[model samples]
Target: MRFEIIGNIINIETIAVGSSIREVERLRKTYGSGRWRKLKGTGTIQLDDGTICEAELHWYEAHGIGKKEIKIKFILSE
Candidate 1:
C-alpha cells in the first residue's frame, strides 16, 4: 500500500493483503464532467489489528472504454 499527497496532487495504492478494513467515510471537493474525471476526499481506514488511520483520497481517470487507470492518494496516518 502507498499513499502520498502534494498540494492538489494525490496518489495512493493498496491491496487487501494482511490488513483488513471495517469502515470507510466519504470524500469531498469532488468534480467531474463528461470528459476527465477527478475527485478529492478524506476517510478513515481501520486495520484488522484495530489500527486507525486518517487519509486523504483522490482519483483521476480519462474518458474511454477500455483499460482505464485509476490513481489514488492517501496521507496523514494516525
Candidate 2:
C-alpha cells in the first residue's frame, strides 16, 4: 500500500490489490504514534466487486504542511 502524509492528513492513497486489513492496521500503528492521532472522519474503500465501501480510517499524523511521505505494503491472501 502507498501511504502519503499530505499536510496534516495521512493519506493511504494506493493500497495494492490483495493487501490485508492487518497491513493497513500495522501502517496505522506505525504512523499513529507520537504527535499523530487517527483522523476520525468519512472515507471510502473500493472493493474488488466494484462496490465502494464507505468507512472511517483511523490513521493520521500531526505534522506541518507538506510533510514527508510514508509508504508501506504487505502481501495479501488470494
Candidate 3:
C-alpha cells in the first residue's frame, strides 16, 4: 500500500543479509549491487486513505542503493 513514514523507525533489525536474502538476485538486478540487507522496523505511517497507524515495515537496502520495495508487514494499531 502507498504510505509515508511519519517519523523515525524504531526497533530496527536485520532479518537477512547478502546472499541470505531470498530476493538478493532480483534486488541486485533491479537496483545494482552493494551489500543488500533485508530489514524490519516498527514506525508510524500515514496511509493513502489518510489513516494513521503503527506498523511493522520490511524492505531491502544496500550501502548506496537505499531502501527498496518497502512493504507493511502488518498494522500494529490504528
Candidate 4:
C-alpha cells in the first residue's frame, strides 16, 4: 500500500475507466454524490538509471488486480 517511486515515468497508458449509473447512485452518499468512475493504467516501471529490465506496473483508481487497491504505482530502483 505504501512504497517509494525511485524513477521517472518512462511511458504509461490508460487501460480503462468504469462507471455505472445504478452503482453510482447507490453509493453516492459514501463515494460522493456525483458521477462515480474508476480508472486503470498500465506501463513499464523502470529504474532511474534507464534500465530496460523493469517490472510491469498497473495502476487502478479503485477495485483491485493485486494485493491492495492502490491508486498509484511505485517503482523501486534496482
Candidate 5:
C-alpha cells in the first residue's frame, strides 16, 4: 500500500492484499506527527475500477505558528 498525505489529508493506495497492525503503527509513528497531524475523520477513495475504499486522514503538527503538513493512510477491513 502506498500512503500519500497532503495538508492534514491522507490518501492511501493499497496495491497488495494484506493487513498488519504493526504496519499501521509504523506509519503512525513515521508520519503521524512532528510535521503532520492526523485528521480526526474519514474519507472515501475511488480506485481505478470505481471501487471505493475508506481513507483515514493523518497530519503532522507544525513546529510553530505556521502551516502544517498532512499525511494519509488507508485502513483495510478485517
Candidate 6:
C-alpha cells in the first residue's frame, strides 16, 4: 500500500536492531550498510485515495541510508 506521511511520527520505538532484523542482509544489499534498525511509530498519513488516517508505521532505517520499505501496520478507525 502507498501513503504519504503528513507530519511528525510520535511514539517512536525500536522493534529490532542489527542481526535481529530478519531482512538485515537484504537491507544491506539493497540500501547499503549501517547500523540497521526496524522501528515503528504512530503518525498521520494520507492514503492513495486522498483519505487521511492515523496509523502505526513500520520501516527500516540506518545511520545514513534513511527510511526504507515503509508500511502501514495498523490503522486507527474513526
Which should have the higher TM-score, number 2 or number 3?
A: 3
- Global local distance difference test of model 2: 0.36
Model 3 worst lDDT run, 10 consecutive residues: 21-30
Q: What is the TM-score of each candidate against the true structure?
A: 0.34, 0.32, 0.96, 0.33, 0.28, 0.95
Worst 10 residues of 5 by lDDT: 13-22
**Cα lDDT listed for each candidate:** 0.40, 0.36, 0.94, 0.41, 0.40, 0.93
Tens-digit lDDT string for candidate 5 (1-78): 343322333343332221322243454465453332233444554555555566664433333423234334545431
Task: Evaluate model 5: give its TM-score.
Answer: 0.28
RMSD of each: 12.9, 11.8, 0.7, 8.4, 10.5, 0.8
lDDT by residue (tens digit), candidate 6, 1-78: 788999999999999999999999999998898999999999999998999999999999999779999999999852
Indicate whether candidate 2 or candidate 6 has the larger TM-score.
6
The TM-score measured for candidate 1 stands at: 0.34
1-78, model 3: which lDDT tens digit per residue? Answer: 799999999999999989999888988899998999999999999999999999999989899889898899999999
Per residue, candidate 1 scores C-alpha lDDT tens digits across 1-78 of: 543333433343433211131111111123322233344556665545666666666544334421123333544677
Give me the displacement of residue 66 in model 4, in angstroms.
Answer: 18
Scored by TM-score, the top model is: 3
Q: List the residue pairs that clash in candidate 3.
A: none
Tens-digit lDDT track for model 2 on 1-78?
333222332344423322333354554465542333333333444444554444434433444422223322221221
Q: lDDT for model 3, on a 0 to 1 scale?
A: 0.94
lDDT of 4 by residue, 1-78 (tens): 333344553455545444533344444444444433443333344344555433445543333322123344443333
